[model samples]
Target: MPSSDAPSIRPRRLRSTPAMRRLVAETRLHPAELVLPLFVREGIDAPRELQAMPGVRQHTVDSLRRISAEAAAAGLGGVMLFGVPAVRDARGSGIDDPDGILNVATRAVQQEVGDALVVQTDLCLDEFTDHGHCGVLAGDGSVDNDATLERYRSAAVAQADAGAAMLGLSGMMDGQVAAVRDALDAAGHADTAILAYAAKYASAFYGPFREAVDSQLTGDRRSYQQDPANRREGLREAELDLAEGADVLMVKPAMSYLDVLADVAATSPVPVWAYQVSGEAAMIEAASANGWIDREAAIHESLISIRRAGADAILSYFALEVAERLR
Candidate 1:
């Protein structure tokens, strides 16, 4: 009915229906591209739900194992574990101890999953340290980077021995990836993969995470974690980690740093993952609870945006539920 001068090209036809839109969708989320982050507290009789993060819990070891089995059954790509010990020390001695809650849970989950999913450990001291710093402190109370590397070396060997398929080096200390890689290789754990938190930023989004882990931090981590204002620094960190033998690189607080994630994914030969941190998920949960948004749709959109922004895998609290839905 249109004249020759009228527009004939129609992009709307592709979006005319749900099936049509899905058929041409550029980004599709799959269960294999999701990883769940879980917390296991030592000496807990039952799972303690996190108040700030609705539906998330600091699980007992038994509950952790059960959830890990469920994650594997849902066909999730992996599960990242964080352990909260009942006791804390200045040096975070529990981090590398074989009897440490983290190590023990790692063994249990790896045993339960058994090649069904990758079992990764958080290689940091913040959860174990009384002061809540990622590294050991010096006499001046400043983080001792070189000394922390030594501790990370020990922790790397311990985690590998405990059956962690991947070690998420998230401390952001200089030369951490290289040091951990060397230590793992020397300890005869050459096959153990390293997932470097290459672009972790000092963001307000980490507030809820402190509650999830029962963090003891009194001051900010600006000295070690990257400033949220720097965009180029993210790519630089990813480059350094890659050169230092990282099998996977991560950008933390996924939705907020999609640019950094896309930058890293554009050039890195290794897999690129992003973490949908506690605050990001918390906002969604709160909004959904208040009936301000559709919970399921928002969750899917948030994850899909991260994936479209070039995250090869996403570490999200929503992983298990999303994966089950995908299946």
Candidate 2:
């Protein structure tokens, strides 16, 4: 039955069945590779759902603990926490305060979860600053890099003191990893890890995130965040972070900057993570709501895309749901 013109090799046999495909799949997604990014607002007695992000919410401290436990039970790797303070000021004084919402939340989560999973804190002042900038401003109204480092140093110690296992240095400040690393080491927190947002870009996909944090910013962060046009700059930033002692390097807006993520991951000596930002999730949710796509399939595909692009871990709004499904 052999034909002279027929091809001898075919690839379809491997993909002909679900079990066959699963057996030979090159990339696999596991619940332990996902990290849930959670928000906690100080004044809310109840969790407040984010409109732009339908399924996500700004949770109360009590609610945060509940969901965090659920995440751990679901076998998710970790949870990254961001705080929305009841009141904000120019310097974001709340960031370093022992009784501040973020610090308090860190303590609560550590007590609740213990070592079940990593408890990470977002080490940025945007949620605590009235101006909604990642760092404090100079007299000229621009973010002051060195001055912000001073703030981050104290904040790093405070987060460490509160029992945060990792501090996500997401401010995009120069030498931020080194500064925070030094502070953490000096404060008897040498064991604490740092997750550096090494290649964060100024992108339109941050809109939903601004709403999530109740940002009061009037202008853009282009001056600090990497320009979207510069592909090489992303790799450069990753190198800088690695040199500065970052324990983990992250590329933000995972889908959009997958090339950058791959570049960083290819060379990084440590674990590389990626964030599936709010806008990315909102787009998928909106499309699914309109019945334009299969929601579950899309979520699975999107996450697999990120993992295939070389992220060791992913921070996603869908982490818990996806993790549950994987289980």
Candidate 3:
């Protein structure tokens, strides 16, 4: 037994210095472990800043190419692209259109930094659908999962043809991973990969994203997205995606779902990633803007927390800025 003057095991010795703390850190965030999510719009002549998400913007095709190149040169892992089209229809036809905004942006970025960065595109229809749903709506106003899978198959081919290194299936449609994977393979894009948004939840945290993507959704996405209360379901979703040929698995709204992220990461044979969703990022920025928290430190802490939760990669709006700091 130790006396009152000395502790049995004093952990403070290692915490005495920053260098010692760094040396013993179990989770280290690196530039390569960050992926930036960007938005590109069709008719915007110049990049327009998103009001809800302070520093993020809706980029033009030209701006996307330039920024993507910059991100590549910054030595970040990759960039995920979401397109805002000039028009939307019931079927979200733009998603599978070869000349659609997303495909066009993907091609442009591939040309600008093809081998330098892993170019990925959002494999979802919400931004392209006038109905503001992730899938095609049936006569009764329900999102048709099977019908949406067909559209995803078409979108997969279009994205792969546009030089996307990987397709991020964020639509939360069931069997999306298998459908997109088979679609890519059959379309002669066998080398292309799929990043399944396996544990996406219908969280209120997507508020800023709705604004960022110009989402037309008037109703909630509770029908397709997972319930936030279910931890077991997250693991089940991850397992399904794994069996369906997903190259990577992702959990959205990372901060609120660290437990799900950790559980998924624990069993995933492939890389497990998490999105520091728009709301999460916006909250930090908003608080920092009010001088409530140290901006840099908060961002670093949030990222490290996500990393400590077992994410192999973090999809963040601040990826570029944070990666620059990490470098």
Tens-digit per-residue lDDT, 67-126, candidate 1: 999999999999999999999999999999999999999999999995899999999999
Each prediction's Cα lDDT score? Answer: 0.96, 0.94, 0.93
How does each model score on TM-score?
0.99, 0.99, 0.98
Please write out the lDDT profile of model 3 over residues 1-327, one tens digit for every residue. Answer: 767887668888889999999999888888889999999999889999989999999999999989898898789999999999999999999998999999999999999988988999999999999999999999999999999999999999999999999899999999999999888889899999899999999999999998888999989899999999899999999999999999999999899999999999999999999999999999999999999999999999999999999999999999999888877
- Greater-lDDT candidate between 1 and 2: 1
The superposed Cα distance between candidate 3 and the true structure at residue 148, in angstroms, equals: 0.7
317, model 1: CA deviation in Å? 0.3
On residues 1-327, what C-alpha lDDT tens digit does candidate 2 reach at each position? Answer: 888989879999899999999999999999999999999888888999999998999989899999999999999999999998888999999999999999999999999995899999999998899999999999999999999999999999999999999999999999999999999999899999999999999989989988788888989899999999988999999999999999999999899999999999998999999999998999999999999999999999999999999999999999999999998
Task: For model 3, give the 10-residue run with minimal summed lDDT.
Answer: 1-10
Off by over 4 Å in 2: none
User: Top lDDT: which candidate number?
Assistant: 1
- Which residue pairs in candidate 1 collide? none
Backbone collisions counted per model:
0, 0, 0
Question: What's model 3's overall lDDT?
Answer: 0.93
